[model samples]
Target: MFARSLGWIVLLGLTLQSVQARDYRYSDAHLHYVDFFQESEGMDALLKAMDQARIDQSMISGVAVAKKWHEDEPKRPRYYAGDDADAYWYSATDIYVAAALEKLEPRQRQRFHPFLTGFNPVDKNAVAHIERMLELYPGLWQGIGEVFTRHDDLTALTSGDTPRANNEAMTRIYHLAAEQDLPVLIHSNITSKRERNPLYLAEIEEPLRNHPHTRFIWAHAGSSMEIHRHQTRLDFLLPTLSRLLESYPNLYIDLSWSVLQPYLLDEQGKPRAQWLALVKRFPERFMLGSDVVGRFDSLSEQLHGFDPFLDALPADVAQKVARDNFLAVLPKQR
Candidate 1:
């Protein structure tokens, strides 16, 4: 009877520990207030979701580019990203995001870290628009991006000149970001979906090399949902990321959901040793993000996905990845 009772006590203790681990409040480093089509569930729904998930803060941005919907087609494409037509500059996206932030009560507003994403990265004159927005809003804008450059599917459908992270236009924007002490979250895909290798490394690498002062948050660590659909898994991601982290002090990674599969977790849904060791070695460099678009209902599950990985980490390191690391990269004024 004493042995059985001791076993029950131990079981209860373990359960309580798991509950405690789940209770850690999160800071979402990557989130979108709208989608390519400009649809959203709006601010109230988002705040309620955040409260439910215990997400203390979030880095929110508008979808940088707009999707083109073809009116004449018999079967209309649901989103412009995959459609045959091209998407164009969507400068008003920033305004939509800013207006949502303004609608919030002061207490509610404090939880958001808004980043500007409406301007064209490939437009040389885009910097002037950003300056106007920053001047108009003053301290309201916290950062820049998920700047969509070299995105799969979206890249093909985008009109005018294809944007690259290393372009002269983007170079000017990086300079502006450094001047304002704002971190830029760029979504430059590491490789094309058709190719299994890191063929597009130069698009992201060139910018990182040039902009040492500007803190660059490599969105989804250069991986995306489209990449996964084509290749069963990315064999090159782990080594590429590890080497980049070692090479660039200004580079931080947004370990969003796309990166979780085949990298952070094994096929059996267990944490991978290579990933854990890499994160542990650089605890301060990694941040958690849901990368959820236009909706808040999935917020909790997205944040909870990190729990297993967190459990394997030491308490301090887990806490850092879950919260501190994201907050650390935000603009100092906040």
Candidate 2:
């Protein structure tokens, strides 16, 4: 009797493990090839992490600005927000990405979709820089951003006039992106931390309306870790996103880690019904991302966190959000 009961317990454990395992693949739609310090674990480490995480492909870009290590600080700040030191636009970031890719075999290189992000968005000359990068490295760059516009504290820490999504410079960039058939991933927060309304909606909406041809991937669905840290949730976020999706077909949403807690999953880590419905309504428009900076230790965890929500979604929609949606949005040629 004891042996029979033990066998049943062992069988149940295996069944549960199989049921919990992730069956679908993933394409990380958003990832930074470097950190704020303009450093990375290199392509080998990245590829290893991607393999471990089951990330078949990734949209990789460099951080636009490099955080400064101010003289007074005794120890180096671990992250950009650790100190008041200002970060400057580092054009070499794109070069780092290119170098990493150049080292990889052709088949391995195909796994990464490199995005150019080493220019100051507030500078009108930025578009020229982007054009030059494309010209310098033909058939290399697949997309144009993770453009830091109106980002939380990063905007203040960045050295320059705050970048707006609809600014003259970004407008020119958008035109270039459209002409080149490259998608633009922009991190423009929908509203300030204190404001419950979408105060910065126009900044992104203007470009979405004016540049209908340009494909814009709204990073973190206009939410950020900083915003969530300050406010429990953006109460207006859902309706605002729903309205935007209805209005603009060119728009896509990146479901990065920042959006996971306050929006995608609830207190018990169960999928929220409203968000599940929203994703189902526009299955093709949403994509998953690890959004990991230089280090990739958390890459698997960050992505697997979505499984609960994904499990709740319809099978087709779940597959799309997990991987297909991101691949679908990439440039047809590249």
Candidate 3:
């Protein structure tokens, strides 16, 4: 009788362990295929990282601007913000992304969704460039942007009139995105570091209101690492995001690594109640991303950082934010 009891106890222990183990799968919605120099670690490395991270799918795009190594600077800058050298719009970035995808097998290629981000957002001809790319790729391109506009320091460093989401050029692009059913991911900051309010809210709001048919994933919910470093936290961010989510049904949020602190998770790494409630309210409108550019060794770490926040959410809501939401927002027919 004691031997029989031991066997049942061991079986129950194994069942409990299975129940306790969390299966964490993710869809990285805001990944960059290359770095500031317009270079990548290649598709092989990216795929290996994805498999280890359990990233079933990813939205890949090239950086809009390429960092220049000016003659004045003796040493090359390691990153875009490393030196005062200006970055330029490199249309060839899209070509690099396409070539990388072509090298992959059909099944491997299907795992990645590529976005075109090589055009200057402020130029009228930018729309034509996008149209030409769509023709050249013929169904290879899945979306547009990570379009740099009104970004903190990058605005001053980029070699062009600063782009605005509501400008005429972007307006035309929005119409094209709507017609093509492509989602556009934009990095238009909500406000400058010095401002306590939503100083630059209109830049994004105008597009959201004007282009209702176009799906827009507001990168890091309009926050960046530079903004966070200066302010520690945007006191107005939660309320501002809540209002926008309610007002614009088409606006989606990208919860990348930058927005993790002082917003999603608190200083101590615990999930904040307000953000949790906000995400739960619009679970289908929020998704997680690594936002890792070029090198991806930290891909798993960047994504798994959301575990605490995900654990706080209801299982179904967490699932949507973790993997389902991004896939849902992709071009429906694609």
Best by TM-score: 3
Better of 1 and 3 by lDDT: 3
Give TM per candidate.
0.93, 0.94, 0.94
Per-residue accuracy of model 3 over 148-185 as CA lDDT, tens digit each: 99888889999979889999999999999999999999
How far out, in Å, is residue 162 in model 1?
1.4
- Residue-wise C-alpha lDDT for candidate 1, range 1-334, written one tens digit per residue: 9999999999999998877744588999999999887779999899999989889999999887777767866675667655587788788888999999998899899999999999888899989999999999999998999898988888877777888999999999999999999999999999988898999998898878888999999988999888888886788888998888898989999999988886788888899999999999889999999988898899999999888988899989999999989889988877
Residue 140 local lDDT, model 1? 98
Candidate 1 least-lDDT 10 residues = 74-83
TM-score ranking from best candidate downward: 3, 2, 1
Clashes of each: 0, 0, 0
Candidate 3 local Cα displacement, residue 139, angstroms: 0.9
Scored by lDDT, the top model is 2
Candidate 1 is scored at a TM of 0.93
Compared with the true structure, the alpha-carbon lDDT of candidate 1 equals 0.89
**Model 2 RMSD to the real structure?**
4.1
| Model 2: lDDT of residue 180 | 93
Error of 3 at 240 (Å): 0.8
